[model samples]
Target: APRCSRDEAEISPFCSLPEHQAPRCSRDEAEISPFCSLPEHQAPSCPVCCGPIRGLATRLPSCQRSRSAVTCRLSGTLLDEDNPPLVLPSGHVYAEAAVLRLEAAHGGGAFRDPRTDDVVTMGSLRRAYFL
Candidate 1:
């Protein structure tokens, strides 16, 4: 069966799924799609890329690890579209929310670096962009 796009330029294991089972979201649809965050409409997350999910197992094949998965150093969770990995000036990486929470716990604008015991301010944080 023809499971992938007719364009023939891109190939992925996702091509094997039925039309209805294909991903509901596309990279360009973020600004226009309304169902991106709806659980029933979201595609199943890859197990290896997403780490351990609670309550229910992931639908992504556990046997094959995604080559692009990058995990957050503090939480060990995948740095995916939902949870971005932010970087501190001291050369440390952490989840976006994790850094924010740590700063808030200390005093709101400054947080102690988990690695070097140095104080890092929110102004020194940088966004880590991934492909």
Candidate 2:
């Protein structure tokens, strides 16, 4: 098991070993911690914590999905340059023409989110682009 000073353990519990294996010492004793062999909790074992971080980074990745994976909620199709994509404040995506028609159907006042019914406006719609 990697070692960590008590202070390091306190600051980042993930840096320390299991509870049963943790060496206990009186706060006044100033004894060496079995985990880190340090007089006081100061140093941290980077290996232990780095492993978890790297593991999570591998298990869950980012920016791996392509733009074609994004589908418009209104049209139920992949967003394209011809139709373009618009995003509401509520994070709902729709084709530009579809948003215009929906807003016109609502008489051009504050529009409501189809899913949550939160009021938004056509002007509040923002264009979405992916690279």
Candidate 3:
């Protein structure tokens, strides 16, 4: 039987048992083993495991679907140079007049983005310039 290392013995109580008495710690068994309770054996956080700011980089682009084809979510009409699209803070694109009308309907107060539920104001809307 293979001997447990000093560090492994200290972390795993089963390591102290005799070879014949001890149950094998296979990779799958280790997941549910009592040793997993140790802080050092815990899973790493997103930042630690993936590197700082990697989460943001790995995230899918919010406007990926809209970039390929432009359409107003509010008016359900194809967007063109004549009726340009404006991008909301939540990344949804809508017709400029449609957004203005929506804002007006809410008494010019902050409105909730339908896609992500993010609060947005007319001042924060920007033109979508895909290149």
| Ten contiguous residues minimizing lDDT sum, candidate 3 | 57-66
Model number with the top TM-score: 1
Report clash pairs, candidate 2.
6-41
Candidate 2 structure, TM-score to reference: 0.43
Per-residue CA lDDT of model 2 for 22-111, tens digit only, reads: 555333444323553232322223332244443333222122222235556565556778778988898877787677777787888666
Candidate 2 ranges beyond 4 A from true positions: 1-69
Error of 1 at 125 (Å): 0.4
Model 1 worst lDDT window (10 residues): 54-63
Candidate 1 residue runs with Cα over 4 Å from true position: 1-66
TM-score on alpha carbons, each prediction: 0.48, 0.43, 0.42
Ranking by TM-score: 1, 2, 3
lDDT of 3 by residue, 11-95 (tens): 4567678888875544432223354345443334322123454443223121112234556756766677877899887677888
All-Cα superposition RMSD per candidate:
12.8, 17.7, 17.4
What shift in Å separates residue 25 of candidate 1 from its native position after superposition? 32
Most lDDT-accurate candidate: 1
Off by over 4 Å in 3: 1-69
Encode model 1's per-residue lDDT on 1-131: one tens digit a residue: 55334432132456567778866544343332355334543334433233344222222222322454777766667787688888888777888878888888898989998778899988888888887
Which candidate, 1 or 3, has the higher TM-score?
A: 1
